[model samples]
Target: MTAVLATLNLGVERHGPWTSVGRSGIDKRPVDHRVQARTWGLEGDLIADKRVHGGPDKAVYAFAREDAVFWQEELGRDVGPGNFGENFSTTGLDVTGAEVGEQWAIGDAVFEVIRARKPCRVFAGFWDVPDLVKRFIAHGAPGAYLRTLQEGSVGAGDAIEVIRRPGHGVTIGYMLRALTTEPHLLPRFLDAPEMLPKHHEKARKWLAARELEKSNP
Candidate 1:
């Protein structure tokens, strides 16, 4: 069976107390029509925190519907597609365990997985769960952040074909762990050349800090 790119969602920043303009794009809702997939992101999608959230490297955020099901069971609440502010909600896609450089052909657009999503305050606030950031880290289904390699229109019901797999064995799941609880596994994250440049730099910084601490202590 083929994986389905089930839904496309978009949202604009709303007024909040978080930033000077209080910007957040977490209130994504499903679009009934095709959305234009561009190099930066879905056309008309408003990203309040462009500095971190939206860019070429993270042009699209994809969450697996299976992971959403997990959340539904854990929270004992309804979690539907686009509930997590992801641009793409997929069914049957193993994004959590995918290689960093995996390529996907979704409708007319092609994307390459670059890294994993890291939970932050904006996400926690959107869910109204103060400890959500911590909880999400523990859950560890951070999803895959993909870069648009070929831009075009992508809509719901598109078939997601894995065009290529990266040379590294570093799955998004393993990468999330290495960057979080499994600090000692930093070396593994470092070894993956397909990893997002910022993430690679972060792991190095973290490892360097640990070494410094050990030396000082």
Candidate 2:
């Protein structure tokens, strides 16, 4: 399936409780001269890829259309329950199956799903709803974080294609569950063939903890 940009939104950081952000653009007509220029020699402008920072639980996650549905149903709105920075909001693609290391082509740009996102307390502040963080954990709509595999332009109406899948059956959701419910299980999760380096370190810590537990028990 192909995902077309149903909407294009952008926002600058604002100082406030949970930050009052709003959509910057909708379906507006392109200027004729600009279109003519692009039709001739000028190339189209490239959309910026969103970035995430901070720890796992406090990390920002971005979702396309289908994933957005999960957030709306779970959080009762289009945007998530945090001041999550999502520069490119997409539609018509299922992001749940995205695996780490798998490359996705959106227009000329290629990005790899690097990891699964985790929710934080900022979510509750954004929605002004209590226990929102818990709600996100319960719903499990934390979107995938992607890194640029090949830099190129991406915009609305770009098609997304999965170039590869991890050899292991383990998914982002599985890892998140393991991290939250059974931190001791991190070793097993890391053994997955597709485990990233960061996860490998986490597994090592878990293994150490497991050894300590065994000695104490």
Candidate 3:
């Protein structure tokens, strides 16, 4: 199957009740021209709340157009490109099903799949949906965050080529479910070392706690 980068989105600072730091970069919009993507993040993108967002581990965020359309139907509204604050809007790709450690080549850049997006209150507030966070978790298509392996220019309509995929079978969707609704699946993430360090630590802690509970009980 062929996959493509449907659009490149850049985030701008927005201030409102939806913002955690009194400002948020979740208000992303599509850009018509090519944009530079660096190891840090895409050029001209504003990232507020640095404590929890943005960095090398999450230099890029990708959301499949299919998933966006699913939400559009679910919400009865236009959940268009960049609406999810994704840096890359993808088409013909399984963004959530993509395995952790998967690498894709787009334009002249290479990005490695790192983790799944964690829905937050800001995301729910952005859509004015009170139960969006809970609903989003239930839907389990949280998209994927990427780490930039090579910096270069990227634009809309660029073809996406999967360069490498690890056999761990730990997908972005699974990771989200494991981290959220199904703690029983947490141990599976341990096999995918390509995952973000924080998640590995979380799984290890969970495993340790589980073992302790078994021994005590």
Candidate 3, which segments miss by more than 4 Å at Cα? none
Question: What digit string (tens of lDDT, one per residue) describes model 3 on residues 5-86?
Answer: 9999999888998789999999889999999889989999999988888899889999998998889889898987899989
Ranked by lDDT from best down, the candidates are 3, 1, 2
> How many residue pairs collide in each prediction?
0, 1, 0
TM-score of each: 0.90, 0.70, 0.97
How does each model score on lDDT? 0.85, 0.52, 0.91
State which candidate has the highest lDDT: 3
TM-score of predicted model 2? Answer: 0.70
Superior candidate under lDDT, 1 versus 3: 3
The best candidate in terms of TM-score: 3
RMSD of every prediction: 2.2, 7.3, 1.0
Residue 21 local lDDT, model 2: 37
lDDT of 2 by residue, 28-93 (tens): 222222111111111332222123242222121346656656666765665531234443455665
